[model samples]
Target: MTRDNGFSRRNVLRSAAALAGVGGLGGVATASDGESLRQIGPADLSDVPTDLEAVPAAAVPETSSGIGPGSMLFITPPGGGEAACTANFVWTDDSGTTYLGAAGHCFLGSSAAGGTELDEGPDLADVEVRVCVDCQFGGLSALVGGLRGEVVELGDVVYARQRTDDGTEVGFDFGLVEVPSSAEGLIDPSMPTWDGPSETGEINAGDTVVQYGNGVVTGETVLTKSRAGSGTGNDDASGSWTAALLAAPGDSGSAVQVGELGAGGLTGVEAAGILTHVGTSGTAGTNLQKAKEMATEAGLSIEVVLAG
Candidate 1:
């Protein structure tokens, strides 16, 4: 794995991208029996509230320019310039409010700039979600190659969870941005390239996992940006799971699914978690089931916007 001296969140993301190509986190965990942990199991979300508008077993209309999972998003930190991150999943509440998922850290300013510390969360009122057009095609060159795209103000942030409450138990490092009604038509709940997070799924040690990350450094090329790896297991009881999938700095908040690859892309996928942080051994994600529970506790009462 490639190593970098910098520990800032930005550099940490880039390092993860580099690790993707060379067999990530060489020592990621495996099952105790040394056998595959892959299994067909569904998460128990029968009690969770779902979107009132979702049609069961219906097809999700494809949108060429819609903003959804895999879209590039930017937000300005308190004292710093704009930073980029990927959207994880789409969510909705009974009141008909559409919310986009992202890492809580994406809304925070760097510690060096006198912003909230990396360990702490940002104030929801202070965050603004900006969706970027034409960013995927140009990558970083878009900024200097004169191919820059405009950033559209989507809406204000609704919630950003503090990583920890009492500094002992870890909290879910997730955030949600409200997508206004005027721009709701631009929303596409499906993931790019590899589709179908058919439903919430479970993650176990050694399970095969696939992800498509939109880190600026990885460019938007499907073949390069999409990755397949195996699950390492839960990092702890904090509603977090670990995996060795390919990722980069801007890939934070990208969705990960428990699935297998087929001729087309992913087949039989179950939305498992949202990418949050990276470690020396693997990447950590907020389990989707747990994220929903946390959102419910915060009075959001949301359901994952599903793909047909």
Candidate 2:
């Protein structure tokens, strides 16, 4: 499985549990309103359905637009702080609402009122989604906190959830941030360094995988943001998979694609999963297919928004 330097990532998560701000990271960019917002935790695992609706394969459109996969997501929860997470794939609902994919844990802060589990709660509000925040300026620009881009006011957290068994976060922690029509011009469905996630596919134990994340732990540097690693296969019945990729605290919610990185990044890539848990065993991801199933159970009629 993906391994880090035994860093108590869970502790980092809890300490920075709100997953709310970039300001604390020093010059990363700050929320303008600076007002308090709501925190949504994961729903019960049993709430997911046994028989889920089959989502059709992602349809590749002739054209795609702006900031999307590989972009940074800034979340500000109720406690008045902001956190950063990497945007995964893009999705669209039947109603024409565009949603950016992220780890459910990204919005999780402290626990729902009166709830003890970290992964239990309702939806989130006032989330600030910034696409290409400092991507154009490159890592140097981001490091010095020069020209951080504008915030894209995507709609609220339409659907977010995580699954845990016996109080253990086994897998399946993912969420969707609805992109408003005004921000459509900035919504590109393609992965940045590595391109095609032509369709959703499975990951085998030995298959190679590629990912790009904008975690603060890596200073949001381009060099370490994109990585390639090997899969360790799926966890037993948890609808999650493990990998040997390099990951850090803010790397959560990054997309994991099944493919190989050629001289020009990933070639013939397929969306596999979203990085959720990073620990001693490895980096665990909620399988892309399983995530869809859970979304279906939540009454969301959506499909992966493929790149051009």
Candidate 3:
């Protein structure tokens, strides 16, 4: 997901979540007035009967917190000070719409009480974010990706969940950050096919193919078990990668390519909705279709608005 903030990324990071940011990430973001603003790319808060509604998929038990922090981990951009508490974020109906999001607040100081004080100024009042879900979460790289983001055993100065002002947030961990180039990383392979090339499907067992994302640069086969299916969850096909490519936290919302020449015309991409799985060690999930909806919901559609 993404957002526009006049404030330098340096000023948009908070300190509280910084500590837990890298380790155990909880809900975080910014807000304006009484609304919680979100920076995540085009996401639809519309309560649709999506597959995500039936999370935990059939493979993973519903009771399993295998999805969000409970079901699994979903990536969120901080919208306020060092502590983008509830105040920092503002959602019209608590359903998180990206239009009102602000990253400046995410980088506010510890003293910024939720949003009592527009600590970071008004730079981030509005912006757009791009993201993809339902792509690579459950397929194969889940376990490895989750554990990898959870903890990197790199000894001293370990930057697991370290907080960062806009500056540092970009490289929070050894992950790839998809900075909205074209409408590329923001489409769902499963949703209706886009104009030119498009990709979709589940990265699960018996799914032979290679994936391309910021992580493990080289294309590699999917790797994992109990992958995500047609649930309300991500459209990312799960799989087991025998080769070695890595997925990192910053790599969320990146592209996931599978096809001939080790590249398909278009498929789902990668996202961070998968938080528990051995195979996901270095990867995540993505759904371009959802991203389009989000864009439309945030008023950043193709008709008008700033360049996405």
Candidate with the greatest TM-score versus the true structure: 1
TM-score of each: 0.71, 0.70, 0.27
Per-residue lDDT for 1-308 in model 1, tens only?
01111224543344444444322211222223232211100111112222212112222223213677766676654443445577878899899889888876566543211112323344546665676443333233322222323345778777665345333112255778888887787777777666767787766788888776655446444455567778987643567777876565567777888887778755537888888655555566688877787777677788888887
Task: Quantify all predictions' global Cα lDDT against the true fold.
Answer: 0.57, 0.57, 0.22
In model 1, what lDDT does residue 214 have? 59
What is the C-alpha local distance difference test score of candidate 1? 0.57
Per-residue lDDT tens digits of candidate 3, residues 1-308? Answer: 11111222332232112222332122233211122211211111111111222212334322221111111112332342111110000112123211111222222222222211222222222322222222233211222222111210011110012123342221121111122223223222221111112323333333322322212111111232112222222332221111112332222222222323235553323222211111221232223333333333433331101111
- Stretches off by above 4 angstroms in model 2 are 1-65, 113-120, 126-128, 133-147, 217-219, 261-265
Candidates ranked, most accurate by TM-score first: 1, 2, 3
What's the lDDT for residue 78 in model 3? Answer: 36
Candidate 3 Cα misplacement greater than 4 A, ranges: 1-205, 208-245, 261-283, 302-308
RMSD of each: 11.4, 13.1, 18.6
What is the TM-score (0 to 1) of candidate 1?
Answer: 0.71
Q: Give the Å error, residue 136, model 3.
A: 24
Q: Give one digit per residue, the lDDT tens place, for model 2 in 1-308.
A: 00012223443444244233312221111111222212112211111112212112232122212567777665664443445567788888788778898877666554432122223464456444444432532222232233234445567776665443333343457778888787787777777666878888877789998887755444245566667888878654667777777665556677888886578745637888888665443466688887787777677777888777
